[model samples]
Target: MIYCGLILFIAASIVHLAFCALKRNKAADATKVFLMPLLALTSALALAPRLPESRTAFVCTLCALGFGCIGDVLLLSVSEKRFMAGALSFFAGHIFWIVQYVFSPNGTSAYAWGGRMFFFIALICFICYGIVLASTYVLLGKPKGVMGGGVIAYGGILCALNFTAINAVVSGINGKAALFYLAGSILFFISDGVLSYTVFKKDIPYSRFIIMLTYITAQALLAAGCVLPYG
Candidate 1:
């Protein structure tokens, strides 16, 4: 039943993206855009694996992903380009995932390692780098137009934070888990990168289609990663 729902969900999403891409200005239908992914997420959650070792963290991550779907919808709605709100929404969602990780074995169940702290520090530095890039593009005079670069900045950091949490839990040793997260992250980046370029630069390309496709893949992978077998 769950797998069937997943298949239906993906089919609906593909149709949604195809329609959005084939028709211009039709991408503004936030309701249709929002519903498909939310359904996919709901169905995915139903099939999530229950593991004694990381059940709580897995559940929390699912919740964060749920919130993230909402964030994705809001990002689509901001026709005027309110980057800050979109960023804050996603930032809140990412923080929840961080909370989930912080409570995980590597995060809270075990002793802190210098290596872990260093990883976080480096991650923070990377976020700072993205912020600088955003400022240079948005804060300066070189504006893209409606797609505020700030939104991209915040979105990038949010993704990075989520990735950091994933690393904390997955440890980069497990092939499936790592690959799932990596693929999801890449898809999300592709989606948002297209959004930023389209909105700010006023470049009209078929990127929205790619964004929809990649976003769906990212969420699907996230759900799958959460359900990996536990020994």
Candidate 2:
């Protein structure tokens, strides 16, 4: 069932990308709506057999994917209001991921690494924040007003998520899962960056193609990461 769901997701992504290439906006939007749910279903199928043992991770993964679906739908509109709502939904999703990683057994193991590990985590976060700050200034120029403040807040959370994923890797709590989380988080950040460039700056040629490609793949990997440790 899990593999079946993944296969469906891949098929949907391919169709969506083809529509994007052909400039079929309506078809692409239709396909985009299914992407996250399929991924959620995939993870749900994988986690179901584990039942209560996987309860916390299961709930967190679903909530993250649920918000992702809402964001996907809301972002289909061009309205700034819709966009802000979508961004907020994704922000909530990231928070869910942070909570999952922090409380999960794999994340809990990092405490034994003590001060040195925390120092490294803090350093990585600092570097990520610096990168985000520089990128915002260079690429998007200075943000203004409510949207600007929202962007900054979102960037901070994103950096924290990336560093947390990196900490999971450094902790070596669950090797494959940690790698998946780190890769997914980095790709998710990149996708958002590309999206911001397209929105606030000039649109890149085929910007939607690039954005959705990375976004879907990042979601898939994150879902897989959520399931792998328990599986």
Candidate 3:
């Protein structure tokens, strides 16, 4: 049953991407509505029986995926506020991820590795990544203000998520979960970056495929990450 669900999830996601590439707005919009929900359901199905680190852990992961679902719908919306609303949703979702990580015993494993060095490295990387993003926004004529602040905050959370996820892997605790989560977060980062570029800057060739490819893969993998058996 779960495999069937995953298959359906993949099929539907591809259909959504196809519609997007075909420029069929309505079809694409309709398909987009189902993508995240399918992922959420699939995640639950895969993870529910695994005896996750804790019930709260699974629940938090579900909440994060659900938030992404909300973001997906709003982002598809045509209104001016849709993008901001979607960004907020995703930002909150990332927070959920951080919450889950912090609550889990293995979540802090990254901090244990290499002592303060990892922390300093993560801080530096975060600042550098933010600088590049700030430059991109400025070049796009989206200067520092309300939008800028939101972008920075969101980016920081996302970077933190990736950093912790990668740390989860390095700590050698629950390698499967850490690996999947890390891969998904990286792809998620790419997806959002591409999405912002598509929205704020000039369109890139094959942008639709690139964005959906990364987006769907990110969600699917993150959901999978949450369900993997904990150490």
Candidate 4:
């Protein structure tokens, strides 16, 4: 039943992405916006049972799915304020991930790589921030509805989430949990990479099809990450 739901989760996301790509029509976006949450909920249902009944894992799973749902809502929103709210929501989600790791049975393992993890996360934020700031000159010139600063902040937060998940996995905090999270992080990175390439580098021909494919893959993997594996 759980595996079936996973397959469905992926299928639904694919459909949502296809809907987004095939038509920029308002109806398409509306359909996708609604479907995203449903997909997330289903994914959560698929994975949550795998976790140990411990409060830590349970709470972590809730936060993962909750933040994922909030993120979906934020992306669907047309308003920047709403989007900012969403970024914050996901930021909180990342915090949950941090807590999940801190409370894992492998607490000692977390310490082994804690310093290295923080350093890398900080490095990523600094670099991504610098790049975004430099590009603001161009973004500001355009009618890009979102403030350049807000855009940078959103990217920074997402990067933070990625790092949080990466750290959770790499730190040996939780083996199965880490595996799920790392997979999600990889997909998210790929999605962002495609988006960055499409947005910043115009030389490459952009396809909504590719964007949807990666986006769906990212979201699906993220939902899978929330499964809260016990062993």
lDDT of 4 by residue, 97-214 (tens): 5565556555323465448767886687668757754565354454254545555665565565666666666566556756666666566555654544445445244455565566
lDDT of each: 0.58, 0.85, 0.77, 0.57
Which 10 successive residues of model 4 have the least lDDT summed? Answer: 197-206
The runs of at least 3 residues in candidate 3 whose Cα sits more than 4 Å from the true structure, single-residue gaps closed, are: 51-53, 109-114
Model 1 lDDT, residue 211, Cα:
68
Poorest stretch of ten by lDDT in candidate 1: 222-231
lDDT of 1 by residue, 1-231 (tens): 666666677666766777768864565354355543555455445644445566655666666666766676667565554455655665666665456545655343343435775578667757875675566455334655443455555666655655554554445433465466556656666666676666666656676677667767776665454444232
TM-score, structure 3 vs. true:
0.88
Write model 3 residue lDDT over 39-137, tens digit each, in one string. 777767766775544565678778998998899889886465788899999998988877777666556533566668667767777787778667766
List the candidate 4 regions with Cα displacement exceeding 4 Å: 24-27, 34-54, 106-109, 113-146, 173-180, 186-211, 226-228
Please, what is the TM-score per model?
0.69, 0.95, 0.88, 0.64
> Which window of 10 residues has the lowest lDDT sum in candidate 3?
105-114
Off by over 4 Å in 1: 24-31, 34-55, 81-83, 105-112, 116-149, 152-156, 162-170, 173-175, 229-231
In model 2, the number of clashes is 0
